[model samples]
Target chain A: MNLMSAISVALLALRVNLLRSVLAMLGIIIGVSAVIAMVSVTEGAKRAMEERIASFGANLLVIRPGSSAFGGRRGGAGTATFLTDADVEAIRSEIPGIVAVSGEMSGSQPMVVAGENWTTNVQGVHSDYFEARDWFVESGRAFTPAEVRSGARVIMIGQTVATELFGAAGPLGQTVRVGAVPMEVIGIMAPKGQSSWGSDQDDTVFAPITTARSRLFGYQFGVRDPVFTIYAEVAPGTNVSHAVADIEELLRVRRNIQPGAEDDFSVNNLAEFIRARNETETQLGVLLAAAAVISLLVGGIGIMNIMLVSVTERTREIGLRLAVGARRADVRNQFLIESVVLCVTGGIAGMAIGVAGAYGIGNLGDFPVSIHPAIAGIAIGAAVFVGLFFGFYPAHRASRLDPIEALRFE
Target chain B: MAAPLIECRDLTRVYRMGGGEVRALDGVSLTIDEGEYVAIMGASGSGKSTFMNLLGALDRPTSGSLKVAGEAIETMGPDQLAAFRNRTIGFVFQQFNLLARTSAEDNAALPLIYSGLKGAERRERARARLQQVGLGERMDHHPSQLSGGQQQRVAIARALVNNPRILLADEPTGALDSQTTVEVLGIFDRLNAEGITVILVTHEQDVADHARRQIVFRDGRIVEDRR
Candidate 1:
């Protein structure tokens, strides 16, 4: 049959059962909409994490104290022994491609200022700590070399501490008791809010490495056992693996570890963290895609069910057309067109609903939402394919019907 | 002087039922000329309908040769037969086979769909045919809206739309009142006068009396050939 007749017949079929057509198409709409919406929300979450990761300077590399475990319980809180100041000096003096290295020893400490006390994390580090972590002191001044040499009792408060301890007056050049030790506040750090790990990073304090070592932990190099963790930042264009190997070699030599002995130190980078997160996102994407596929199958089943009923209903019509000179192919084409039209229409409706759903979720989530063209294209293309694939058997059945038998049927 | 438009030699059709073979048409031979209004008359189960079906190319003969419009239909595939039927034969059914919810014009244009005419051209031709069948004012009206005689007229117009060489009608007036039957017969007479070969199947004597020639069949064979 010609294009005109095929289209007219399909239109007539739809018009005849407007409500049934809509109901049949609802399945496809829901399937496509759910797929698109779930994918969009998951993609949005992934993008948000990537952006947070990006905010931390890409050049920065963190030197923690343990190897990253695979599928094991997370390494946290005293499992990895605290690294010492000697480790930091050894990397600075001996290791090549090491730009800025600072040993950090952070712990939560109760602070009091005029009886207004709030607990906050206390980071003890050298002057290079700011440059190493890419953070800056927003007020007063960071600890100087003279203060580190003298082991002066001066501290740098974070924004949250400044606000809680000093109120509206600001805490520059004030004194706050750090665990019953009165330390003069020298600097205040800019707010960094929560880290990507969801830790309250801003509610913390900073102090010189010497003061924290001598006063808080009560240790001084070999004479007293010292406990401090080290953070090292690799230089630009330096291979992190090479830097890590170099640091390991230097530490092994400095600590006098024998050859073939296991070294007790760990170096981590942003790349590893990003890779883990990416793998997690990839799994999520696959899960969502699989769910979408299942829904599409359900939609296709719905279409097939409806088309089979249509074939049964139009049995006499098929017979009459055959008797009046319609070929089997023509009969098949008519039904196929009907099925495709139903799906395409459903796809369009699904797109609308999906887009609206995405917008609603994006606003409710308070995160960025991306509506990419490739997603819409995939949805529509998938819908059409589902329609055609599922609609085939019914159309074939209609076309293969015997004209004589069909005509004789009531 | 000219070769007959329809010719069948020992045409036979068999049906398989309940693990047994039932011959619907044993062996039938017939010939029909152009512009002839012929009727195949018989009671129920006399194989008259089967013979008509084979003649119209709506069914394939299980055995024997059948030809319509000088083409041997016995050797043709379903697709080829469909094309041949579209090109050379028109069918009128016992119940007017007009599509429900479709305009009379569209119903008439159904056969032309196989001819691959454009929408406008098809509609125009359908309109002209409907007007010729005295349904000019009811071109856009649906089958349910029209009377039985009007519906049959639309079916007849659909049959003639392709300008087939032969019109094969099965029980054209079987469901109609005498008045409507006479009206349908008047339209058929007019068509036969216009040199369209008309073959009608009917048991009603008054319906058969309208035809220029008639044939009686018994047990799948022509019992009497009267002209």
Candidate 2:
């Protein structure tokens, strides 16, 4: 049969059972919609995690203190005895891909700024910390290397602190109290939204390492010499895994670990972090795809069932067509095309509904939803395959019909 | 002037009925020349329908050779037989088996479509065929909307769309009124005059009389051949 005739016949048959076709398509719509929605939510989650991991910079590596014991406590005491500024400097100098590194000392306290006070966390770091973390001042200038050297009480506040301290008025070059100590806020960092870990990442202030080490707690080695996490940036285009390996070796050697002794440090790179996030996302994606496939399978079974009924109902018609000179292939093609047309139409409609449903869920809920083109293509392709696979029996039966027997069929 | 258009030698059709056998056609042999309007007359159980089915390539003879338009029927597969039927023969039925849901134009267009004509050309041919069958104004009408005579005329137009070498009418006027039957018979007479090979299968004498020659079957065998 010509393409036009095939299309017309398929369309005419679909039109003849318009209500049934729509219902069948609704199954596909729900299936595809679930696929799109699930993928969107998972993709949004992936993006959220990646953004949090990325805020540390593409070449950034986070070094956290690994497992440690103190006085046989054998549990976390909000401090670990391992990581230090020397380790950070050693990595920066020895690691080939490492460009800059900084150790963080975190302290949370109520800060009073110009008669307004709010409780916020403060992190003390070297001057190179801004470059290593890809953080820059949104207003005014960051604390200079000289200020960090002199242990000057200069600080950089996040946008949230700036807003709370000065309201609509500018807070650049203002003074804020940090644990009964006054510090100069030379700059305000730009707003970084909520992290996947449910923390407002920018709701804090940054102070010079010397001042935080000397002025606030009065001693450096007070609590098992535990400070904060160390962050370092590697050079661009450098293999992160290689950098991680090099950093691990350097830390092990510096810490003077004996052979077969476990190192007391952890190095996390962008690739591993992103891989971890993607692994979770991929699991969720598979789950969503399976659900969509189940619905599509059910829809396919429904089509097969309905087609079998159609074949039985049109037995005499089939005989008449065969008797009137229709080739078996023609009959086969006609039914095959009908099945495909139904599925394709259902797929399209389902995709549309899925997109709409995704958008609705995204807007109505806190979950982020985004429609991806690859997912839509996959859903539709799967739907078509399901249609063809399940539709075979009925189409074959119709095509193999003996005209004499079919005519005689009641 | 030439070989017969259809030739059958000892054609037989056997049906297996629960370990027993029934012969629908037994050793039937016949030849039909081009442009010959011949009728195959028989009672309800005389196997005329079986003979028509065999002659139309809708069924294969269980034994013996049957050739139509120089093609061997027994050797042809289902697909080949279907193509041969589409290309070389047009069948009319007693029930005027028009597709119920299709319009008259679409029904007529079916054969042309099977012949691989494009939609525009098929529609044009269908339109002309319907017009020839006096359904010009009823092209869009469904078979259910048409009278029995009109439906039969549409069926005839559908049969004629591919310009087949032979027109096989199996009780073509059996379901029509006498007046409608006469009108339909006039169509066959006109088609015969135009030198198209026409084969009519009927039990009615008047319907059989319209053909130039007659063959009568009884108990699955042709008992009389008259011209």
Instruction: Report the number of the highest-DockQ candidate.
Output: 2
Runs in model 1 deviating more than 4 A are: A2-5, A57-60, A65-194, A197-250, A258-263, A274-290, A359-369
Model 2 alpha-carbon drift over 4 Å, by segment: A22-27, A58-61, A64-82, A95-99, A109-120, A138-147, A150-154, A165-188, A215-217, A220-226, A233-285, A359-365
- What's the i-RMS of each model? 1.0, 1.2
* CA error at residue A147 for candidate 2, angstroms: 5.2
Give Cα-based local distance difference scores for all models. 0.82, 0.83
Candidate number of the best lDDT: 2
lDDT of 1 at B133: 92
* Residues B1-227 of candidate 1: C-alpha lDDT, one tens digit per residue: 98888888888899889999988788887888888889889988889988888888888889999878889888899998888888888889988878999999999998888877788998999999999999999998998899999999999999999888888899999889989999999999999999998888999888999998889988777888898
Per-residue CA lDDT of model 1 for A51-169, tens digit only, reads 66655555556665544433233455455455667677777888777778887776778999897999988877888778777788888888887887688899988787888888898
Candidate 2: residue pairs that collide? A29-A350
lDDT of 2 by residue, A8-113 (tens): 8888888988998887666666776777778787887777666766675667888877552222333455444657767777777778877878888887878997
